[model samples]
Target: YAKTSRTELLHFTVGGKDAGWMDKRAFTATLDKATYSKMSRGAKIGDAAVSSKHGLYTKPNNTAEDGEKIGLGSLYANQNVQIIQSAKLSTGVT
Candidate 1:
């Protein structure tokens, strides 16, 4: 595990690519690793900028159109899912 310190830099990967330096002026809080990377890299599989203040490297989120890519959200490991409705878009009886 990495040491605990305010200066402790976080290292992560996006779409199999490594994240670069995250310094004080480079990155800030409320910017989670995944979210930050996505914003920075312009929501693509490689490095780019989503906003002036955020750098990311992945597709930000999913719309109904992202059928094959929907599984990307599942990479979070701890995320839990439960179907709230049926294929017919009716209230599930179960």
Candidate 2:
């Protein structure tokens, strides 16, 4: 399996009527054959703590950009504000 840091905006309908939107992370979207096999055998996958269960994804290190802000922390603050940047626009993860 390949690893990537990407997110996608998904729009879909359930039961052909209900519509919804979500931010889908690429890393946990699908499972590879080998990892599936291991899971089928009752083996834990992905990152694990010493006293806890393992995660599903083989390499779940996915991250999303929440944008960068360069301004006053409080809205009431009387300070010069700088420009604020938004997160990158993404169609899908490669």
Candidate 3:
């Protein structure tokens, strides 16, 4: 396995597209729906917090309404390790 350091810079990708730069030590975790909702509502997980006007949901086979693109939450990843710069959204197609 390749070893990574906290200072190492790496490209973050989603579905083969470049998202942004992130520290090698940075990563994300899946939280329960309740925790996710809380974070979206300005709740903190430890010292990290997030706030958004919309709720996270999945509409399977759902098309975008009113030309609204699907959203990827800024806090979808763990806030503690996020060091992203010039972050970009992914189409999530591979």
Candidate 4:
């Protein structure tokens, strides 16, 4: 896994299609029917949570982005938010 951030777009290797944005962080696109079957509970995308029983990227986090408002929150913490400002990504995590 690339350990993609919630906002990073996922590209499919088998379908040649951009799986789409990680809406609320995607553990998996649950691509093919077979792929969906392979996952179990406890999987997650970003700050979003996965399905209760079916962990294979079943449910989406459903957290919407706060548009033009003042609040107590971080940008990168949201799905699909750019990390260019929050942290640096190099060849390694450490």
Clash count for candidate 2 is: 0
Model 1, 29-67: lDDT tens per residue?
A: 342122121122112231222122332223332212222
**In candidate 1, which residue pairs clash?**
37-56, 37-57, 38-56, 39-56, 40-48, 40-49, 40-55, 40-56, 41-48, 41-56
Instruction: List, residue by residue over 5-86, the lDDT tens digit for candidate 3.
Output: 5366667679999898876557553322221111223432232234343333343112222233355444453444432222
lDDT of 4 by residue, 1-94 (tens): 2345445443344478556444345453322111112323342225433222223212222212322333223322223533221211232221
For candidate 1, report its TM-score: 0.20
- What is the C-alpha local distance difference test score of each model? 0.34, 0.34, 0.39, 0.31
What local lDDT does model 3 show for residue 86? Answer: 23
lDDT digits (tens) for residues 1-94 of candidate 2: 2223665666667789757666655224433222111212222222223312322221322322332333322332333434232222233322
Q: Quote the lDDT for 14 in model 2.
A: 75
Over 4 Å off, model 2 = 1-7, 26-28, 31-94
| RMSD list, candidates in order | 17.7, 20.9, 16.8, 17.9
Candidate 2: lDDT over CA atoms?
0.34
Off-target runs (Cα >4 Å) in candidate 3 are 1-6, 28-94
The order of the candidates by TM-score, greatest first, is: 3, 2, 1, 4
